[model samples]
Target: MLTVNKTDLVRHHVPVTMADRFAFRLVGGLSTVASVLFSKRYGNRAVVLETVAAVPAMVSATLLHLRCLRRMVDDHGWIRTLMVEAENQRAHLMSFVAIARPSGWQRFLIVLAQGAFYNSYFLLHLLSPRTAYRVAGYMSEQAIQGYTRYLEDLESGVQTDIEAPAFAIDYWHLSPQAKISEMLVSMRADEAIHRDIQHAFADALVAGKLLPDLPATDLDAGSSIGLDEKRLDAS
Candidate 1:
């Protein structure tokens, strides 16, 4: 089970380079577009966003795998780490799909968005993996904020705190009586972990390190690399 530190939920990466700035602005633009499209419909928003969120990890893993093959060198466990992240994001999508029950038009929009984002991110990764990771980092930050809003709505009775889907319960090992608010909290923590990992990858790239010595936060443990402490102290 994943244990989320409250500090991780509020951690933010301060942009330093032009690439980081561009990535931050890019995600901000997308967040605005999502807000205009979804408004207060957080469930539907999650379904669409999770579909796009699941892309970068798989793309990065594929490209890195091929790069390692070509160079006959080790990937230093990055391939598995990215693959796990991809699977985790996919699980999030499944959980939200069950809860949101998106309509046909929303489903169609999901396909279009996923297709466009996948291809664009693929090309961006080819050109600059550092910026690609930075974009993902900022995007995860947006997701955290979105989920936080959802939690607030649930708490304030603006949205009903419905029972969590069975899939989410099983995936997260939640209690049978878990509410959607609880699920949102777990998902928010997952997004925080993604945010930290992506920013760490971008930082490693900026420092000219091929692979960073991150903490061993494997799929089973559901732990993060603990970047928040250092970042918070620095801030």
Candidate 2:
């Protein structure tokens, strides 16, 4: 995994177009709702947020695959990039699940929220992929902010700095004695990459580009951490 510099942790995309404004407002509304529901319970919030976060990449990859097939053109690596992103997000969800140990009702809420978000995002992507990507980028920015606050709480002794989950340590190549604060730092780096990639995709679409290169984050080369199917299922 690439090391995340201070600049990477604080990046944000400015909204200019009407579509960009729409995405900004939409993410803001969702963030408000998340705050209302979870308050400062960042662990539980992460479980639900990561569950929903895993959806858009899979949806984009599926649609792009179909589009490539229909047009008889190569995807230029976008499919694999999106699939890796989905896998990374899934790893995040599973790690948080271990940390949070969510209740049965919370799990049910996750299911409902995931289904609702998947359908809504699928429709949005179909209608306007550029705007959809912008929404994703903005959502990731919000995730970075949330994780930063979570880290602050951990560091300030507001939230307990628990030992990192075993799966998290293995997945992120973290030290055996790592704590949840370290895991959050790693996860925040992942979110920073996601934010950049999503905005890059949106910018490419807006520019009428056929093949958009992945950002210098180098996540497309598998620099980001991921878990295999068997390992994920075991976790």
Candidate 3:
């Protein structure tokens, strides 16, 4: 029988996907609705443009959200529960882009533009440790919440055949807060790196860089730098 090692225990990595972009999406969606209303109220191109801007914001946020999740699935295999979720998003975007409607492309373009803005923000934050630190603080809060929820769920009468709890107890005892903090901090650092790479890809697109015909995992290899975190040092 194999024995469990406390040292090898790791906290679950929750994806900052749609939840992270909810506010942006909600605001953008509302703005889009408002734009439509204003356009109807007064036949002004300005209102149409304002409404059109929301499309990009919504698209970019949604696409970036999916991109983030796809990376998560790559890092950790598809969790069945999220399977439908991931599929639904892809489906919606595909239909939205392909739908034959006036100004559909314009709206989608707006979404694409938002993606660029968000990606730019992600890159800027990635380059600046100070900004990343701020983001880390936010991430830490979320991590702690996830950790607590996991613990509470496990504390119930039910038990798994696996010795995960025993391992967790022993491991957490050695350096509880330190481990959690480290995991959370690492999350923030990775977020910065992801943003940076995404920005590069977005720029390439802006500069007329053709989308490469790459394998499913090709992007995985290039976009994922966190795989080497243990070997890399922070200056």
Candidate 4:
């Protein structure tokens, strides 16, 4: 289980080095460009964008797990947050999988993208966790933008508003008859939460005052993934 002082979170986060700041900014820039190109290539970019959304969290969690193992100390709340984020994004990807019904080539593209992203993100986190986190924050911004556009399409009748997936309804506590726009709203909220967390983690890293040794129990009891099992059940 993870623990946090919500009070501090609002004001405190990792403070970053110049190099890390630059690297993170560069990634954010590239992400913006990618979002544009992806939308141009695909009708809706949510499926592919959300597929890669889980990358940073998974990468961070793996590293934090190993760090915890080697040092035999608490990883603050980073592990739980990262893992929860990964699971939440997985849900987003899952819902979109059913709705988007990606083509075979798109599916293969997912595999390739995940493989490349996972390795690249892992190395980046290893070299500089701060920058890696910033990258995730940027990626979440991209996700939000894509989902917003999808919602716009639905509202404008460019695309029909479809019934929300059962999993989305149950997991989100959305109206049983909720539609895709409602689901997208819930998802965007989740992305905003992650975006904040990523920035905070980056700030914590910069502050150099974030980590403190802890007892054996994990510090991740609270996370957005609290809804994950229910979402899975609906699936």
Per-residue lDDT tens digits for candidate 3, residues 146-190, read 333334444563322223222222322323323322322232233
Q: What are the runs in model 3 whose C-alpha is more than 4 Å off?
A: 1-177, 211-223, 226-235
> lDDT tens digits, residues 113-168, model 1?
99999999999999999999999999999998888888888899999999999998
- Which residue pairs in candidate 1 have backbone atoms (N, alpha carbon, C) closer than 3 angstroms, thus clashing? none
Q: What is the alpha-carbon lDDT for the whole of candidate 3?
A: 0.33
TM-score of 3: 0.25
TM-score for model 4?
Answer: 0.77
Q: On a 0 to 100 scale, what is the lDDT of residue 168 in model 2?
A: 90
Q: After superposition, how far is residue 45 of candidate 3 from its true place, in Å?
A: 38
- Stretches of candidate 2 off by over 4 Å are 214-235
Could you tell me which residue pairs clash in candidate 2? none
lDDT of 1: 0.82
Q: Deviation in angstroms for 212 in model 2?
A: 1.4
